[model samples]
Target: MEGTMSESSAPRFRVLMFPWLAHGHISPYLELSKRLSENNFHICFCSTEINLNFIKKSKTFDEISSIELVQLDLPDLPELPPQHHTTRNLPLHLKSTLERAFYMGKANFQNILSTLKPDLLIYDAPQSWISELAALNHIPSVLFIIVAAVNLSFFYHAVNCGIDGTNEAYPFPAIYYRDYETKKMIAMSQESKESLPEDAAFSPKCFELSSFVLVKSWREIEGKYIDHFSFSCGKKVLALNLLNVQDDDTKEEENNSHIMKFLNGKDESSVIYLSFGSEYYLSKEEREEIAHGLELSNANFIWVLRFPVGDSIALEEALPEGFLERVKERGIVVDGWAPQAKILEHPSTGGFLSHCGWGSVTESMYFGVPLLALPMFYDQFLQARLAEDIGVGIEILRGENGQTNREEVAKAIKMVALENEVGELLREKARELSNQMRGGGEGVLHEAIKKLKDLCSKNK
Candidate 1:
């Protein structure tokens, strides 16, 4: 359903996209931009230098020459190192410092916007001020949510119901529901305590301010929640899938020969790929528990462990004692990064043990790998629910006080990765749903582009 207009018929318009510093947000925005560029649209992708470092080196970076990756200079804070330009490794409190740095770039950003004068602006949830800037310049804005619709619906419902903290009628279960958004609510309360007008809605006014809201999901995956969000937001809500799936046919896999050989040696559907998301390094106790779970499951695995940048990656100390020697024959523990998409498509990869970040979920499901989800925080818990509801995944249970025990982690792996009736059923359902992602309707993404064009046409 992808169509390329001839030279004479191509539309001429400029779009400026500003995603949050997180990898979860920046990745989807780039995917959408790549889609837009095929229609002859000019794109301005803005992020800090630290955010762009990894992106600039990616293979996809070469695929899209049309996108101008602009690196905005965040204000220099004494507490932060020049290399530490993002919030990836910083403490939770220092996250506020990253926000302050973003606010400091407003003047520079406005100047860039004035010069570019893009027809439309696309932004993320936390930085809704970009929408206000678009309004000031008389350009339409789109709130492109990187998270799932269920999360957004919960946020809108919470604000409307005046349940900022906890109330009896809260939507999710009592334990997770109470802990799900407590930190976010506390942050919102703290922001309120600071100097601000009584009329300020919240930190992220994405729902309240934008003309259009776009989510990286579809009606098939989350129909009822999508409808609920549309009704609550009172704006045009579009749930179109925009994942730029990397294919194995590409020669990129050849670059990582050691990994390819490891996966190639394993039997078909024998190995589980395990990774926590980019953010949130695993605690020592948590890491040891996961290591034990892998040992207990007796399944072949390639566990990708992410440590802090510039830290020495000593596998012996980080993992349990004798863990490397114990599982060396059947398991391989990779440090830092790996080619995720390539490994997921390998025939050996049967399931994914993940942090349930939406981006990772989209990739895992699209490639037909059943999920063993261990959701940590933010929108991840809600994302894990999507997998459970679809019956293609099983959640790793935590304790009453939110402790992830070794036994529960082992059980989840046994259910999904090991050969059993339950594992086969989950894997079969996963393959079926994977096709649903692509073939329900061919023109879904094409239609989304048309709508964006129509919005831009109005401005001209």
Candidate 2:
């Protein structure tokens, strides 16, 4: 259902949705924008020129006619190369350069808002400077997290520590890092076997400081997460879950199309889906190791290799003798990219060998597919933790030096794809969670839109 303020209410409020360029961030922001538009709020969705180009290519802008798409032209920073469009391709130097650009972008954004005068601004958590910009202009702003509440809680409560303005103030353990058992916790986390609570509640102060702090989770799948947050807020803060739940037939049709093309019937239920997300590119050696492992296992697989192998590192040369010829009929290696969600939802897809990106995990869970998480870095590590904790996945063993070998790779693939007992349990858990997540999403959305309408009415 479309969200709306009361009919009697006049349309006065304008909203600006400024999301980071990644699809993981952009999709959720778009979903929220759609709900806001139904309330008759004037909306402008902003993106950098590069991201806008991507949206154009995907026809995402065309899907939402009511919300105007605005592409911001970034000035030529002397530090950045002109061709650096996709953030995924950039190295650490370019990332630092981009952070500086974002600060400047905030100033440019303020200038644009001077004329447009949006009543509020909503941005991803990384854009903390945007909050300062909004405060300067007397506009209310909120931080929208694309991650689950449990992860956010860990960041705020566990990982971070600060000393007070007075040097005399002692460093007390934060809410997230409670109970003072630090060394043991650290060791356990390293083992990759420990499990934290499946969920966590939002903090009271987080709600008190913001007009709304939007999180991308629903009550059904995360009842404990929701219950913890709800009680802490005392019903004062609004919790919204924006998810586009796909119906059975629609999911099946999309999945089937991808599956048929990829599989072409080499071996039934033998194909594994391998995608490590856009940002995490495997080195040439690692890629070779993976290729060798897949061939050794003799399993049919589709691997999404985003980066091309260097001229000196040809995949064919790297493979074991007669490996390519043997598995040529068994495996399909897709270069650059693939429609991840569609492939994950396919009936022929037995398991996912993923980078453990939250969007990837969510898609896998929604379709009830089991996982073999190969987290390389960043939030992926945390996602791996959640996946294992939730009993929906098993972590692929990376060596002490944070590397994967041919033997480990072969074993992990076999475990998730061929092992009946483990895969069955995982599929069952995933299905249960999937239903809860999609089921609670609607109720949460309805309540959020209502609260938004009420707030809009009060402003009038």
Candidate 3:
């Protein structure tokens, strides 16, 4: 149960939250901040100036009170560099930039803490150095993981590196048999000499440095992965359901609008929604291939194609001969950013051709929109497993050695868009899982906040 504070019982605890500038990271932290604020906790929600300005414009932030939203401005560093602002490079740049930004943030945050020393500091995982500050202040520093716990199995494997008789080059599998019991494991492939793909942000180094780690996933939704990977960590491995809102009555109306405008009264399951998160983009060839695939599938789609992968989008030239003209009546090509959550809620949107980012995955499951997982890099391969193995969505097979072809894309699209065998089952599972996400979700957040509070109160 969420605790209520009386004027006399209010603990006057201060909490600081630092999120990476990207929307994906910022949104989840914001949700936690809002909940904490309602419990009378003072919060400093920190992000770069550009993102703060974007939030100022968005309706999401308009009604926010209680929590003090702090904009940590970097006049020298813009959101992205001039030439290489593609989604693949932005995260790398943001991570690098934060090394400097972190210092500035610390100065500002410390100044605030001096007047009122915080009882707790809740930071995103990447903000590792904050743990030292918390230790010095004798406050509790809890690391908040934005991704799923299954993804953190990579970090756990890294921590046991070269332990016992294991080799450093080949880290121990999370799975192992102990003296009296068998250690469970998240089924991740062993790391090899193969380099990480461009989009991967989490690293083993991150896990080694932190004392506490918490990821956003629920045992009810991801019971296998949680039971296997997190059983050893105990309270250190917290499993919380992601918070999202979707209403069936509202969704039914939205679906009707989608079909009336785009699909000519076709069934709700006939249309597909395509998105590559906020960071990814398609090359002209890849875009054309996708366009061709959708056309071949004879499926209506809402494709959110931003600027080309590396440069300005010459959309007309990049498209196949008269492709735009042919699909104008049959498809909705959003050439720039689309309101993704809104689009996903539409009834006509039966499946998602997603990049498999955690935020996208959570959103899909929350809306009961089954996915045709198309992971490009990062933790996406692991994310794809949640859908495929866990039975909430169907995983599309890339070509040999995890490659893709236009034909394969077409087949996958048809399978999901038409509510084919796997699609129907995944859809049913998604609805079942989403129901749990909305219910048990608040209990988890309430428990986390209280746990952090108790840790502070005990030590204070």
- Highest lDDT scorer: 1
lDDT of each: 0.77, 0.63, 0.63
Residue-by-residue lDDT tens digits, candidate 3, 207-231: 4333455567777766655554554
TM-score-better candidate, 1 vs 3: 1
Q: Per-residue alpha-carbon lDDT of model 2 for 1-460, expressed as tens digits? A: 2235454366546777887756677777877887777656677888877766655544345556477777655567876644453465555335545555555565577776676667777777364456666666776666666766555544443323331213222222211221222333455344332221111112233334356667776544444544444444444334465654322244335544654676656444467889887666777678878887897677778887775223233446545567667777777666555666666666778788898777777778777778888876555665676677777788877665666788888997887777767777887888788776666456656766666655545544
**Hey, what RMSD does candidate 3 come out at?**
7.1
Q: Estimate each model's TM-score.
A: 0.89, 0.79, 0.78
Q: 1-460, model 1: which lDDT tens digit per residue?
A: 1256564476678888888888777778888887788777888988889878867775566677588888878788897665666767655555656666676677788887888888888888365566777788898888888788888877777777755534534354411343534665556567644633322324436556677688989677777778878887887788878775532334544555678799999988888899987777888889988999888888899998988766645999899999999998888888766789988989889899999888888888888899998887778877887788878888888877667789998888888777678988988988987888867543766777787887888888
User: Could you tell which candidate, 1 or 2, scores higher by lDDT?
Assistant: 1
Estimate the lDDT of model 1: 0.77
Would you list the rank order by lDDT, best first? Answer: 1, 3, 2
Instruction: Mark the regions of model 3 whose C-alpha exceeds 4 Å error after superposition.
Output: 1-8, 73-116, 125-127, 158-212, 227-235, 244-260, 308-311, 400-402
Q: How many backbone clashes does candidate 1 have?
A: 0
Regions of candidate 2 where Cα sits further than 4 Å from its true position: 1-12, 82-88, 91-93, 159-209, 220-240, 244-259, 264-268, 308-323, 456-460
Best by TM-score: 1
Residue-level lDDT for 300 in candidate 2 = 76
* TM-score of structure candidate 3: 0.78
